[model samples]
Target chain A: MNHDAYPDSYIRGILNSVKTIAMVGISPNTSRPSYFVFKYLLGRGYRMIPVNPGQAGKDILGQAFYAKLSDIPEPIDMVDIFRASEHVMPIVQEALTLKPKPQVIWMQLTIRDDAAALLAEQAGIKVVMNRCPKIEYGRLSTEISWIGVNSRTLSSKRAQILGKGVQRMGLGTPKD
Target chain B: MADAERVPGFATLAIHAGAKPDPTTGARITPIYQTASFVFDDVDHAASLFGLQAFGNIYTRIGNPTCAVLEERVAALEGGTAGLAVASGHAAQVVVMHALMTPGDEFVASKKLYGGSINQFNHSYKNFGWNVVWADPDDIASFEKAMTPKTKAIFIESIANPGGVITDIEAVSKIARKAGVPLIVDNTLATPYLCKPFDYGANIVVHSLTKFLGGHGNSIGGMIVDGGNFNWTRKGQYPMLSEPRPEYSGIVLAETFGNFAFAIACRVLGLRDLGPALSPFNAFLIINGIETLPLRMQRHSDNALAVSEWLSKRPEVLWVSYPGLAGDKYNALAKKYVPKGCGAVFTFGLKGGHEAGVKLVSNVKLFSHLANIGDTRSLIIHPASTTHKQLSDAQKVQAGAGPDVVRLSIGLEDKDDIIADLEEGLTAA
Candidate 1:
């Protein structure tokens, strides 16, 4: 995928397909963006496995923390990097060692590692750098539109009325 | 470089969160997006937007750029995941209830609430078949007893209106958690500057932006903030959040939007159908009002404390009921939750009774005789004759609007002038 200007479909496909996310560098601190993103994905029905060496045995929002990606018992669908750009290469390298290796590596906002991206792609993994999954999901699902953010996608179709009660974020139901 | 991960402070967030300089004009302040509808790029784009596949401004009533900034700013201030701005404080209440309750669902609410909310709940909500079980906020056990299987939410005001009674939010929150219901705190009296309900485990926060948040009496608005904590999908209690939504191709809001789903539910389901969209112009004014919230709130608290102290000593006054007063019953709770001070609004009683209450309101000079609170100018009201006139005598007293009670919304005025004006009102009474 082109890092500079990836098409919307590329992002939509990744968001729709991913089920479980491994958030490396997840913090216990509630104010941290990583913690917010981790909590967000968990609420959105995505299973989250937190990875932080310092908080290895501790729990975050009741989810047990893992010391490393390899410590996770199940195969991760995506590895979301919340660490500094300098730390991405090690995380990507470690992620590649999983038995049923992850399909995607997503870096949080303002974090990009071109060398790590190339390595991950060469090993048959898709990479998204300097982007946020929480934001992408909200934008693609039209949830962001409620707050008038210019999501840059529009359609002529009127919002289909679900029932007599309230309609939801235009985003479709999560497929198991 | 180390500053990359630093979260901005409250003062910084109040000014810059959810906003950036306009790319086109480099406008320092957010410009009002006044147009009714936005132009779509093509047929595909339009289809995507309506289908909820893409996000963009489609119509002002549904969403506006100006209102979006205000929503984000308030959400950030309240430590919430998301926020929805509505036409008035009452509209916000309606939207929140509309999202949480279907016909026949019940919610537990604190008796110490604004008279308008009590009326809205007791009458308007009953019409919709949403039953409200009123409980005393002072007794945590009262909230626990009010809970039933049908209870979907627990509602309370932080630093309640009229009496300035500080609620024990954390204790009530425990009951909500055990009952598997969301705790909704109306933070109108104590803005986020004084107390962020989210910090004490509130699942949602509602505000009448018409009050201190707008700071001035110029605009009327309200907001609902999703704390993003409650598990809406648990036990399938809240179908609005857990069940598949038919409108957007059976999309489940709780499963898609995560922590922010409740706010989205309010927007797409309630605001869209209810048609209580906040005007972009009013959004603009309120956004500007929020920029000085910290400064104004501190001064408001300071001035209110002084006035409360002065009133306690007056022989004409039967009692003063500001939580910020050291010996007030709610003073300890105020110290715990609203340590910044118990906000600027409070009520007092006259020794001369109902006739004196009416005369005191009439005699005040610098203080405006008005129904609104949280204005820059001091405001006084005899609620029994005005806001609570419709309620029966017993109901009026229960809502802290007794015949002899007078409410004052202290302003950011010279403390001496405010005291002198009240002195004049007392002498006349």
Candidate 2:
């Protein structure tokens, strides 16, 4: 993978297919960016599992936190890495050991390691780097653009309003 | 990878950037969401909405679906990260300053500006303890001299009102960068069709949509666009973005919202408390006006240039101040910045002085003698007797609104008709 840019279709496909995500390096503090992302995704109907060693055995937004990815009891469709570049290799290595490997490994904004991405790609797992899933979801769905943020995507198609008059758009997945 | 993604052009964005078919009725036009509040899904959903953890409409005062489309369209046109719509151009200025300025803080602004803005900055803003420091757009060094530790922002107009002076946006932007402040450009006259201030290093772009963006003069509106290039977190200069807030559980806006933090600040903090919101009906009208912005602006510019050229050769006109004409002082900067055209508004001095200006306005047949601009009908105003009446003689001259100056906002009328009407007005004067 070039890792320089991921096409919108490639990102949208992963987002629509993944129902549950495990966010590593999430902080207990609400002021942190990671916590904001976690809360946002949870509100968007994603099953968010926080994996933070410091906050292990506690709950964040009503979701249990585990010390590591292996401790997640259920299958994870994606593993969202929020740590620094130096710590990504060990996490990717650990992800390769899961019985049914996660479909995608997404690194948060400013966190990228080509070596780890290559390792994940070799194991048939999709890898994205230096991007935030929260921002991507907002961009793809036309949510952030409501308040004047540039989503860089334009469509004439009317956004489908879900329950309660809330508008949500899907990646090009047929089931979505 | 798949074929390279195709981005929409300017005209396409102006027509469809923030709009979609109505989801419930499937109406082709965006419906006016005429309600005060929205019903929540439940207690938890309501909590999430109030906490800023979710993005949805809660109240009309903060956000409305109809206004949101207009906001998105303008932001797209300006190539900005985000935009916020407010009541009027002056209201937009107030909201922006509310976010950036504290008591006793100051901002540097160009001396060449709309007479009403000068009045607002000089008298009204002082009540808030926000001092206005004047700088000359003609003298770029005056901007550097006006800077102080108290300066939070630098304000200028891309193409000044009445004078049609083309400001050195890039030069002033460099000074602003060196001073560690954001540069705010009032792009009311230039509009996004003529110039994108962000392209010239402006950190923020503001507009009185009552003008060109709305194209027609039927509606009143304003907008603030975030360029998303300035670092609000640098050295903790902007506490509104850097510091934690107690209102929504202490989340820092810059950290959470990233590039569009300034827009969020203006909304969640400023607009929420100050209470100057753009109505949905006006937003709908503005959105319709913007659909034909490119065509209207081109005609306005073409007609304006033709009229300026005609007036320059007339014996009754002493001087014409339009940057689009050859041999004008600001023509080079105009060509560099707004190559498309110098916009529709410009001023000309009468040989008979202030009384002649008053006579010309009173006698004009095709041109409507009014205080507004950017209308489909040609509008005329004598600044000395009307708009600039509040300013002193020296101040009026400094703002390019001298006693003899008569301003014309050329419209989409035919070039010959506009000139014929101007000839009659000058002959009567």
Candidate 3:
């Protein structure tokens, strides 16, 4: 799929389906973008398995981190790559070797590897490139539009659900 | 520049980060959204906005588009996650402290700060049940000793006002990190052009936009930038972020907003309740002023250094206490923190004492005898006789306002003209 041509539904579908994520290249430093994305997804109810060789055996946001995706005992629904484009191919190969491979491969902001993405797609995994899950979550939830960030799915239609105590995030159960 | 991976340079970010041509009118400049409230799409839109599920302008008192631009620009320039603009410098202080401390909590503050800030911390904050524990910035060990179980934050000025003393921010930030509290740096005197506190490990940066930021001194405004470097979620130390807030229907801000939660909290709770909103008109003025900060700061620093050197040579001048001067105690700190320049405000002592200080303030023709600093025009003030007049002699000295002291906020005039102006003051004294 052309990454830009992928419909909002396609993007939203992946977000709703993903339950557990293994974030590679996650940093302990709060100022780093990886730290924010990790904490944000965790707060949004996704179980995060942080994989960083340097910070292995440490805890981030109360979750014990592993040196690599292979060390995570539980099945990962998605693999979020925070490393550079050059590093994504090896990370994707590593993800493909996992016991229960991730259903989706999501690259972080500024990371795009067509070859790695093609490999993931050929292996029956979905691919998202050069996008931030934290920003996407906020965009879909209409949290960022107020501050003038374009969410790209402009429509006159308001959300059908109303008057209930709003969920902090606009995520929901995956529709199979 | 279109690539997201390439970080924009400082001048580019300062000019373009939070601003875009008007999507509605195609105005090149960020136009002031001067209305009181925005029209919601429907009841559900309003509800989601109020419910915190959506973010948008609800009322002017809480947020405005023009002020949001100013907030975002400064945040980008400071390398922070987010920023909130408020009415005045003191208002920014109250909001930031309110977000961090509850009643009975204490914060450690550098004693070498602006005279007005000293008054605000020593007197006004006491009424809010937020205690200020003073620590001498000259002695880095004093900050560590001032910390107690009640300490919620560490506060200092990047380059302290009136005296131009550059703080050892990295050293103080380490202490704050060890204590598990945010380090708040006042970057009013040392604007982002001179120093970026976040680069040295500050968790939050507060600025008096009334000064250097609003360079022409046309607007009275302030900002609070969330450095996104503090773990407000750890151990429930910051109940305001980690715990469910009673006002927002038990919603936890940190859980919802991630790194920018402190900035959001200050806007949602602190400014919303305190009601110290920066007017949209002032926001426009300040934003315009910020577009020229890089140019003005360089000139201001150059002029101040030359003026300080001239003052140092005067036989009637007892001492010049400018960090830019090599022989000064804070010179080394200035080189480390404010390498671009040591800012334009500094104090000097007259050999003839209080009478001469008064004489200098009275005689300067080019310098405006005003309380404000960071104006385009030069300003001279005898703090002991004016700004710090209420304090006792000993208190004045402690606040860097001795009877012989005369503060000069060197302006962006030709160096010879500024020297000539000061020359008249010295001759009269």
Candidate 4:
């Protein structure tokens, strides 16, 4: 893992800086993966501007859906992608064309493109590839549990030797 | 390169390509040698195996003769250099990623993908220091825009999970090449018959064999296939593949194994350390599934198209989503990428919303009310209530899981029975 590429401290510093995120592929159904990711982010208190052409006029989770990233009235701190890879460049290009370019272009899992990343990099934007912000926020600062019990505590010799217990891992608890 | 017979056609290879009569016992099938370790020729031979001077099994977790057949057969089916089997799809992704990403380094990927992958790339991997950058597979430019100095690979599925949207492989591959990054395509949904991402320029392929590949839904497994085409030696790109490993006598993978080296790296390095080896029993099941893959895929597509058209006309239905449908937004993309057939999985909506969608899922008899897709049996699920239940109201809407949405995984059974079941469900709605 390259900590230099994503400075955890720097990411923590900017946590409060982002007020709104334009989620391009927001879903209304609660079971979708994006739904939980969006839920987690929203629970963290970030305002998400949903972008789905299908439900353009409808409001979801108390947020209004805009047709595109550019259509949002407020400045979007990040253009969180939930669409396919082929659908991203246009959004990224649109993000670039914004009067105030989004500080981050976060693509979802299994989505990737080179031209868009270069464009963002050239424009002096920070790039996070193949990673989810929700997970990062949890792991770096959250009390993510390690695996195994031999019943050891953190930083103790037993903890270092046997690790911890299975229940500790993840704990399903929101550390952040 | 070592000589191996290259058989043409999928079924022919699935049954006969990889294995030969046992040189020792004359057994026709690849026998599962249930053992912990292999006997060495001598101390020098033992030292050689330990030092990585030769390829031989030291333990069941690292390598097995029977599992090798599954890897070889899958590699043949996928038309790649070699293949590696793992415990699950998540494990495969984790191992493949270690080959390209060096913590915090990024990989561009498709947003329309399996739900589990979304969680894996987004949540589980963050602790390891990897990051996911989303891009639209339909638009090559979107992928190009997401690249950065830290970008290692571009990832997408041949046919996305749940939605069954086809990706423009050639277009996405073009962007990946221009960026000088390897294109990684998850061919789980498309399998090899419907689409071969390697032919379209994908350097690496991954699959969750638990789905369509294991048709019976009895086992969980995954595979990583390498095209052996990408040159990892490019400047500062993938030193993991190109550079020498301190663990293995400091020999470079690319220098020795060449194209198939990536597969070897995944098996020897990633799988070795992670201990996510696939069970021989599951590998056998996958082989069984591959035998009928070509035939099953054909019906799966045909039945899906028929069902989509049926859903579009129902008075009780709101909207039908299938790539094969003429007016569907992704139809053109499907035609270009999946000319043979679009997949069996698709989503449609009931006139009423959450209640109606739930009613339809419950009323259906033939359609199994389950979360999985790519099954031989017809399956259905209401994501808003089940899959997306964890998300807040806002998140569900963004994920295309509105109250009315109902997903179907059309099966090998008579399309009529499947439709009849859905027909009753829609009427109930």
Q: Evaluated with DockQ, which candidate comes out highest? A: 2
Instruction: Compare the candidates by lDDT and give the number of the best one.
Output: 2
Report the lDDT of model 1 for residue B79.
Answer: 83
Angstrom error of the Cα, residue B47, model 1: value is 1.8
Q: Which candidate is the best by TM-score?
A: 2
* lDDT of each residue in B1-429, candidate 1, tens digit only: 012224567777777655655434657688898989888667755765565444456777777878987888898889887889999999999999999998999999999888789889999998899999999988889999999988999999998888887889999999998888899999999999999998998998999998999999999999988898888876468888888777766667775565677998898888988899999999999999998999999999999999999999999888999999989999899899989888889999988888898898899999999989999999999998888888898977887899989999999999999999999988972
TM-scores for all candidates: the values are 0.76, 0.95, 0.78, 0.69
Model 3 TM-score is: 0.78
Q: How would you encode candidate 4's per-residue C-alpha lDDT over A31-125 as one tens digit per residue?
A: 35466567656745688888989989998778788988778887888888988888878888889988788888787655677778888878987
Error of 3 at A55 (Å): 36
DockQ-based class of model 4: incorrect
Task: Please identify model 2 stretches exceeding 4 Å from their true place.
Answer: A1-4, A163-176, B1-4
Local lDDT at A12 for model 3: 75
lDDT of 2 by residue, B105-216 (tens): 9999998888778889999999999999999998999999999999999999999997898899999999999999999999999989899999999999999999999988
TM (chain A), candidate 3: 0.90
| DockQ values, each candidate | 0.07, 0.49, 0.08, 0.01
Q: Alpha-carbon error at B74 in model 3, in Å?
A: 0.3
Question: What is the TM-score of candidate 1?
Answer: 0.76
lDDT of 2 at A146: 58
lDDT of 1 at A57: 92
Tell me the whole-model lDDT of each prediction, alpha carbons only.
Answer: 0.83, 0.88, 0.84, 0.73
lDDT of each residue in B1-429, candidate 4, tens digit only:
011122255666656545544434666666666776767656744664565433456676776666666676677777786788888888889999987888778888888788888889888879889989998766668888899988888889888877767788888888888888888889888888878888889998899888877777788988898887888766556777677677675556664454566887787788888899888777777777777888898999999999999889988888888889998888888887788888888888777888888888889888899888888899899999999889877777667677778888889999888888887877763
lDDT of 3 at B182: 96
